[model samples]
Target: MSNKVIKEPSNQLEYIISSKQEHEYSKAVNKLFDLALTYIEDAEKGNRLGRKAAWTQGVFEAPLFYACDTVPISAIDLGRLSSRNSVQIAEEAFDLPKETCSMISVLLGEWVLRNNSSVKRVVAFNNACEPFNMAYELIREQGYDVFRVEGAIRPKLNHDGRLDQVIKFLSGELGDLAVWLTGKQLDESRMAREIARMNRILAKVRTVMELRLKNSLYIKSLPTMFILMGSGHYFGKPDEFEAVLDELIDELNSSDVIPSPLGKVIPLTWIGARGLEFGVYKAVDDCGGALLSWFTPNPYDRNWREDVPPLESMARYILDYFLVGSPVHQIKGIERMIEQSSSKGIFFYHYVGCAFGGVHVEIFRDYFKKRGIPSIGLDGCFQVGAPSGQLLTRVRAFIEMFS
Candidate 1:
């Protein structure tokens, strides 16, 4: 009936990460888990306080739901609880294809377990992989109200006129989504306020990223991932999340942490979606590699422009997302992260059944290969412990090559 039901496993993951070092930033990590617990508890109860709860297909849509005075919970948040079990349930009970994205399968299984869940509204975007689009439809078929925010396709030529049209189109779509959820127009001021709060959180995350790049030894890959992942939905509490970010930033800046010894740790850039298995981080760590930057979430570096109208700014933010843009743009972004982090290679960890990045693994690998930057593509799923021994072996070999 309370968070106690799911708190133990979440804390276990946190303990594993925080136990790695004696940094003060561990306090912030604790805060993040606390926030996630609160959100998960409220979501299970179908609402938070008095706010209506809505399942968000992705993190980017959380801000919009916040503006609408609704609680937005993501599948990523749910999958963090018992991903391996969820995937098994999806396969055995739901009869979902094994080829379905593991994240989607986990979501479906979670939804099934919570059949009595009072939450009925769902918000999703069309820019994601096809599996997600199909998952939304499946959720809708079960009688949950689903509202999708349409995305714009990037044009071949970049021009202000075309860009403006795309923004306008997306703005209208967002406006419609707001009205559908609230039966009233979205308040621009309220949306702007939410954007401002998130921007503050993001600014702090950027500082953490810089700190990690400078001293990768201070915070390990798993903890760094936890921090960046929180920015997606602020773990359902923007104010508290911002405070946690500030604490983390202060700890990183003031701590007397030393960089790793030269030739001891291989600095690498990860260019793919967030990994679900803890072993993935462990494999890299065990292999003497420290991920300096994660490219997928880095698109959040482009903060919402407060100078512009809230709706228009939101549109621009969605359009400028790395996945929504061309492969060339994504590659360019990856190049920048490699250069900035002085990374020795790239780890393209693509999720199985993810058409977004999984299908393009070879392109990224070939591009980096021609440029003399070693890259490896490891196919994985969202289930916990899904990282096979063979996958870890490949990771070890890759790091050994750098050595």
Candidate 2:
């Protein structure tokens, strides 16, 4: 995990884009990964000791990743690299249960095997779900400095001083981490700059989300998702990410009827984690449908009110992130997406071994059923290997039901 160049990613796309010559997006994604790795390398080499944050924060934003020089690596990314044997490597090394091992377990194993030396600190948040809780404990047992944070989730929707409470809790936890890691207080200027960069990234993300509905764009939703989400570890160089996004918007604006997989162009809403499967998005389009909304975790998922304090603004962003709280919030998010996109159907993605997602699928399915919206469930992890003849057939059938 040092600045020492490791083996190339087994996945061809990761390989293609990791190359400097492929595309702006390829370069941007690789740049983000490299930047995060550089920090880890620095930490490993004692250049910046104790500045690393292991994100047991689940899908919520880790402000320190960009706001400061600390390295922030998501546990989800640490587990599932495109290599077929990455999980096995984790399983053997961590003595993880073979039968019921979830992605998070495998991911912790991967991080343990690959990044144990560089990871000096671990940050866990409440309400990320059970598997994440278990993973957090495992990290602590492994002897890294661990910090637990409270997330914004109240029993009653709107209570007195809820916002204030959330802000206080958020600041307390992150602020303490900042002090512990860097021995400095939160940098207002640095946080503001990072917020500004994130705002721009989010704006582009919204545009891409909207443009996915446009049949004439002819671009796949996967790249847009990847660019917006940035391999789930860090979003490096907003300008570079924006460059690729601008190219896409230009292409979409210039085109009238670009070729696409969406046969009859029936728009659908994707309700699940992001980056689980690019193939499913393509499959939906290929089966005469358009995936207008893929509800993965977005840090800047909402409008950043200039009226609010930067720290509070960042807190609110994480509070409202799609994956932060309960399934009620997720259901509301799906309902809003459906209304906004005017989607004809919903596709619930369940990663094969993720109980959190699996449990929520039934809830989503039931909700959609009550709404009289036809929804289908698909299974996969974070790769293109999700789509199969059976899955494609199910997608086609689902689209046909609407047609």
Query: Residue 86 deviation, candidate 2, in Å?
Result: 3.2
Candidate 2 whole-model C-alpha lDDT, 0 to 1: 0.59
Candidate 2, residue 334: the lDDT equals 73
TM-score of 2: 0.78
Backbone clash pairs for candidate 2 read 79-107, 261-285, 262-285, 263-288
Off by over 4 Å in 1: 1-25, 46-49, 92-94, 158-160, 258-263
Worst 10 residues of 1 by lDDT: 1-10
Worst 10 residues of 2 by lDDT: 16-25
lDDT of each: 0.73, 0.59
CA RMSD of each candidate after superposition: 4.7, 6.2
lDDT per residue (tens digit) for residues 160-185 in model 2 = 87767877778677777667667788
User: After superposition, which runs of candidate 2 have C-alpha atoms over 4 Å from their true positions?
Assistant: 1-63, 80-82, 99-101, 116-120, 143-145, 160-163, 231-234, 261-263, 299-301, 330-332, 382-389
* lDDT over C-alpha atoms for residue 316 of model 2: 68
